[model samples]
Target: MTQAFEGIRIVDFSQVLAGPFASGQLAMLGADVIKVEQPGVGDQMRTTMANNKLADLKLSPGFMGVNANKRAITVDLKHPDAKEIIHRLLADADVLLENFKAGVIKRLGYDYDAVRAVKPDIIYCSVSGYGQQGPMAGKAAYDGAIQAVSGMMGITGTPESGPMRAGYMPADISTGITAAFAISSALFRRTHTGEGQHLDVSMLDSAMTIMSPNLNKYLATREEPALVGNTSPTFQGTANTWPTKDGHMQVSVITDRMTATLVQALGKPEWADDPRFTTSQGRVEHADEVKALIGDVLAAETTAHWIERLGNEGIPTAPVNSLKQLMEFPQLEHRGILATVPAPPGVEGELTMTGAGFHASNGEPKVTSAGPRLGQHTEEVLAELGYDAAAIQAFRDNDVI
Candidate 1:
């Protein structure tokens, strides 16, 4: 079966996380993505967090994570011959994804207007921190900065610990997912309108949208969310993390039925008849008392024991898994969300990387190859642009590609 983006081609000029992640999603679904990078330096992420050996090979685990299923080419956009080459590539391209700071792409002469001049129906997507035209446009931002500014950190930790960013790159990952959705939507719209789109995806905007539940509460009630730490927004004593004999386990006994099940699981069915623990509101009023009771009971049992006992009772429960534990999770082996691809050059065997979040009936997301080495397909891509061998060599000598 044909994939969703089987015939689509993208010129991806994004790096680091957000832009590359967006394009990577399309590539996984069969878009022909050509990742354009500098001649030698390549993407900053290629070596950002890599160790000495991986950095020397320009194959950082972080880079390999998002760049699978794409080709790589080098180009000096500042070089005079660059325009001709880019025009050739754009002539048949359906999408252009970039994450440069606002005005940077324009300064390099590949703004939407110039690109539109070449491919009138091209989907131009620009991913940035604050957006294309704003008071904070062009300002430098990273995941941590976005988290702090987006109020994500403010509501994350306990009041004692103050604000804290999430352990993962929520802002960058959310922005990438948002951009991918926006680009896909644009493609869908173009089918009927036959007009291209300019997508301005902002990490800040995406973060705000992701926090709509908290933001909407503030908007309606004019109240700020408190730092609750591992506490559920429902404020129910039964919906919080507790220490077990072996480890930490989180539970969400939201509804009365679930709470009853939880109490039964704890061998405390008598609590169900108590007035202070009968209803959801009653539980909230006696949160501390109820929490202490649950904690005392849970602390006597092993995490694995409760997982099985409470899980069988229909209570939402999970153990806080470390990275090692998560990687070895048995359920993940069946999910197919992790793809095993051939190792990049100099590596042996296979490398396991993440793919799409969900599965499909057909044309499921996959990684055909590991992320490309820097400029690994420069000659091939240039040759496809109608550049002869000698012309390609000349561009290399001139540092134009």
Candidate 2:
């Protein structure tokens, strides 16, 4: 496989979304990622599949969504001998990832200080709800809770809906992606400096970065923007999602040219001539009026009709697609961003997971497998560690594996 991380090894003690996603991205790039879950129960994400049918196989779609190309092993971290297993893995691992609550990994004796002792050049990353030394560091936080703390929920929904959580865990997912990016960059830095360091990634900090545009606006104005659903929060009403006769479409009126074109496309060229619509800022000030005029005419036609006409006129507009529609998007199919992998045992057909969000000239990414089953690689990995059958059986009998 022509993957970037082919020679790297990652031992991840992270659970749930953020940590798994980060390791999964590295795995997609062909890292030998060992995902260590608790014995017997495994990572909680294996059961977070919700109503999906693959829970019996211990590979939920939600789990498979990020765990492709990973080797999972179950080790009870609370056990005294767990440190030996972790040290053995870290002796060869280039990176270590964990997302347990603050101080948990350190208490378990696998923290950055301990890990670097085993491998001085190891990149150790700890993802937490807050940072390692914040007032909220000790508090338990999940995605939804972090979203609220990070001001995402406050600005996510419409004013009418009050504060609403995102449908998916953006905090967890984006944090994971950020962690992977940082991990790769850290490795690059090590190549030059011959040093490795601890990385502290906070979900709250990540959320703020995701809200940077809005946060910038707030800092400048000294006031948080009110929740305006389906509207551009930075530019206010200039960009909006309008209901077409058959469906909804988002139209961006960021520049004067685009606004004029939109007005002309609506057969209201005279509207752009008005002083209220003369400048882009003026148009933004009168955004409601602009949207009403455009949305009225747009509401008379189907989304496809508006998209075709607006696209030809150089107006930025597109049909608001649902999740399934996005999955079936022709552009995505052509781009080959997703790959279908072997179905986990007992499941039918195949499972599709996304790649590393780019194309490689050598070949496609090495995302070749689905999420690992519970303890699926435990015996195999132990054997590779020079544990004979008797020792393996003893570990199993002692409930250590």
Candidate 3:
């Protein structure tokens, strides 16, 4: 069966995580994505996390993760010839994705209007720190900066540690997801109307959107929410990572029935009778005492012991797995969530990419090709746009490819 986006062609000018990740999802759904890069040096991520100091900067695991299933082509957009080449490619393209700062694309002469002049139905997406018309549009922002600006950092750490950036780049990842959804929606709209529109996605906006409940509560009460660490505010002390005999286990007892069951499992059912622990609100009020009591009981059992017992009792509990543990997880294997893909040539490693999140009865998502080597498809892609052999050679010789 044909993949979802079989005939779609995407001109991807996105460099780092957010834009590339969004395009990667499209590629997985069978869009033909050509990643545009600068000549000599490709994406900045190609050197961001090089393993060995003296090694060539072209090999980066960070680059490999988000850039899978796309082709790469080098182009010096600063050069007149290269600009002409990009316009020629855009003539038949379905989508154009970029992650430059606000106004940068317009400055480069490849804004939505410029692209629309060439391809009237081209879906143009711009991913930025803020957005196109905001007061902070031109302000520089990386993942950490966005986290601070979005109140994500404020709610991250424990009360004792002040504000802290999350362990991972939540802003970048969240924005990537948002961009993918927006692009997919745009593609669907294009199917109906045969018209394309510009999409402006903001990392700060995406991050703040994820924190709506907390922000809304603060607005209503005129009080800022304190950092609650691993516990969620709505769960009211019902969710947390507790210490087991072997390691830590995360447990969520959202309802009173589950809480009572957990108390019985720990041979402390009397705790459920306590007025301070009777209701969810009361539990939240005396969360520290209730947590200490639960901790004392959980510390007596090993993680494996509790896992089996909890599973049998219908309590939602799991070991807090590391990446290594997760890779070897039995359930993930059974569910076919992970699969190995060949690494790029000369990379000396293979990568484990995830399959689609959910199975489809109608059709399977395709992985057409692995991530392209820098500018690997320059000649092939340009040729598809009707560039003859001599013209392609001239473009390459001029360092305009």
> lDDT (0-100) at residue 126 of candidate 1?
96
Which portions of model 3 miss their true places by more than 4 Å? 53-57
Model 2, runs deviating above 4 Å = 234-238
The sequence of per-residue lDDT tens digits that candidate 3 reaches over residues 87-141 is: 8889779999999888888888999998998899989999999988869997778
Please give the distance, in angstroms, between residue 162's alpha carbon in candidate 3 and its true position after superposition. 1.2
What's the CA RMSD for each of the models? 1.0, 1.6, 1.8
Please give the ranking of all candidate structures by TM-score, highest first, separated by commas.
1, 2, 3
- State candidate 2's TM-score: 0.95
Better of 1 and 3 by lDDT: 1
Highest TM-score model number: 1
- Candidate 2 at 212: error in angstroms? 1.4
Which consecutive 10 residues in model 3 have the weakest lDDT in total?
53-62
Steric clashes per prediction: 0, 0, 1
C-alpha lDDT (0 to 100) for residue 378 of candidate 2: 94
Write one digit per residue (lDDT tens) for candidate 2, span 25-92.
88877889998888889888898755656666667788987888899898888889877877888888
Query: Each candidate: what lDDT?
Result: 0.91, 0.85, 0.83
TM-score of each: 0.98, 0.95, 0.95
